[model samples]
Target: MSKPVLTIFYQFNPWDSSIGGIQTVIRSFIKYAPDEFVVRVVGTGAPGSALGVWKWTEYAGKAIQFMPVIAVGEDNVRKLIPTTIAYGASLMRHNFASDFMHFHRIEPTLASLNWAGDKTLFIHNDIRKQMDRNLGGKAILWQQFPKVYFALEKLLISQFEQVYSCNSESAQHYREAYPELAPRVAFLKNGFDPESFYPDKREEREIKRRELAQELGLPETVRFLLFAGRLHPQKDPVLGIQAIAALADPQVHLLIAGAGELEEQVRREIQALNLGDRVTLLGAVNSDRLAQLYRAASAFLLSSVYEGLPVTVLEALACGTPVVTTDCGETPKLLSPDSGVVCKERTAEAIADALRRVLANPDLYSSEACVRTVQPYSAPSIVQEVYRQMLHRWQYRKAIAISSPYPS
Candidate 1:
């Protein structure tokens, strides 16, 4: 018998490791897939005037096809409409010849409404909550559309054979939204690459911290409160700066490692708040550099208005750095008093208070304790379970196809 082929879809440059947590999870799935399965990855790229060809690539030493659809857009929201149409058109034109299709996020799933085969959806965030929080600016113009759009999206959700959420909180939310399909929803938490993120020795960490300060042009005595995510409305980069301003601690600095549409706005806020010396935007850094930042930082800060289980939180914990985040996603459940702090509110004051508690007693949240907290979420272990589940589903489908009296 041939190995079951699994086509994984995500509407972004999947090869770009710096994109965010979603890419990390996708890469993990590809990297740790079992020998009995063949996984193919599909992503979007600039329009090449014609459809691009599938190129076989070696990812984590496994041979797989890297297919790109010629669909381009400027930003996340803008990319949705074009990517959705492009994916639907691509599916219509090409036969992936796979036993199963796994989609990340809503757009691709929306495009696959006509697919009658074994398919699954990965929910990375609380969709309803995220839409509600991000419905501002020009989004207010089409405010009524989301109500009807998501109503249709709910119907789309019912079409999937299985749905995996990044956190239990989001899993529960989706279950409540679609009561009849509640049994199909499951929580599959995110994990960090243990090889890429881990605690550095005390002597080595101090040396790296000094080197980082010299590279970023900061004082040798400065302590970093790192924020690593896209500077979008979802992450609320401005809130992080506000929290830093509220802290009013000269020895502490906020280092933002990612950039997005809010870049100019973030710069303006830094200047307006007179936090130029206290805040540094490093733009986007690769996985190695990010791991170093996690090692050197005093604490990882996340001020998002909402989230699913954020991979940054897991990476920070894996790197032996405690996280100080607003109460969102699975932070409250994932973090313990000794490992990290979960803020009671989303306000700057609340975040500042949490930072104060972590910064004041650094020894209380020991590196060993922090690392211990996320050991259960090791990539190898988590991805193994993911592959096992996929194989089981594939086997069940095969059994049905073999026993059925009618053609599949």
Candidate 2:
């Protein structure tokens, strides 16, 4: 009789200011949710003040509630477990009225899976595997914790009523790791906001492009290649710089935006490659400026070896910019003959070839085709699918509850 209320549990990485794909999904669902449902977001705070809550209104239907828990110290395993458990209990008690609960990442709060009336966990990526893979060349301390984290994730996956992954790759990974729950996993594609990214006015685009180029000290004769995302090893930002180096075209410049732990390493690599003047490490450009960079660039490049579903590629296409990406995650699924190039390998030479081909013949891919390929990923369409499935499951559970007769 009454509309069900959906509560989302999301992780907040304070160091990251620009919203990521996972955060975008939470925001979209809240913004476009049907009138019948109520949506609330619960953000886990970064280490330090891990037990405070803040509320804010974001859009017409979505409300955000952020909780800060005491910060977990590095290598302090003794305190991590207790803090996670305490935070989970606090979150469960705070959102007691929610009819359904959705978690953005697999974390300690997932312990509440047993109490939430309806539960869904959206697997963005196999975090533990990533941590291990990316830490291969890093400090020994960083390598020790992924093993512990992976074990905890395996335990959490078993408790969910339903599991959703951003791409088929993630779904398969989960299925192989947890065969018992494979049948319950569903695929939910990531989407973009068309209103914010659709083709810009020609005059406006040109003017904005000029302004961006001037700000970045890019020359008018140079063709800009944009890579937008965290500057982390997992993203392979160094590979992007390597690709630009191989291009050896002084006329082409690579713009690396966003910051991360690998910043210093990437900078050293750029200099070693003799790309000091050619590669620009802009470091964490804001959303508005990022949109302008997308419009100005001759093409967008993604060097990630693994990803959930990169919303950046979709946003680039939505802005009518051709994209060049590796065959990582769902990138191949989103690309086509008209959109741009999709390479088979993550090597610098592979990416270099793709970039050369697109820049050589931009006429082959039209703005119309780029827009068409990314149309289904619009925020409204994707959110509608999420709501439909959630409501369907809720109804099925209600039916079962009514039919199951209590002991007489």
lDDT of each: 0.81, 0.73
lDDT of model 1, residue 45: 68
lDDT of 2 by residue, 1-408 (tens): 777878776544322354367766776677788877766665554455536555555553354444444343321122324444555665655544367888775664455755647777887753444565453434223355777766778777776778888787778877888889988887877888776787875567667667767786877667789999877655788999999988889988888877766788899998899999898888777566777788888899998867778888888999988899977768788888988898887789999999999989877876778888988889889888778887887788778878889731
Residue pairs in collision within model 1: none
Model 1 C-alpha lDDT per residue in residues 67-125, reported as the tens digit of each score: 87656544333333445556656665665546788888665565567655678889887
**What TM-score goes with each of the models?**
0.91, 0.83
The runs of at least 3 residues in candidate 2 whose Cα sits more than 4 Å from the true structure, single-residue gaps closed, are 13-19, 44-51, 54-56, 59-61, 64-66, 70-97, 126-151, 176-179, 201-204, 396-408
Candidate 1: misplaced stretches above 4 Å? 46-50, 71-97, 133-144, 399-408
Which 10-residue span in candidate 1 carries the lowest summed lDDT?
135-144
Task: State model 1's lDDT.
Answer: 0.81
lDDT of 1 at 124: 86
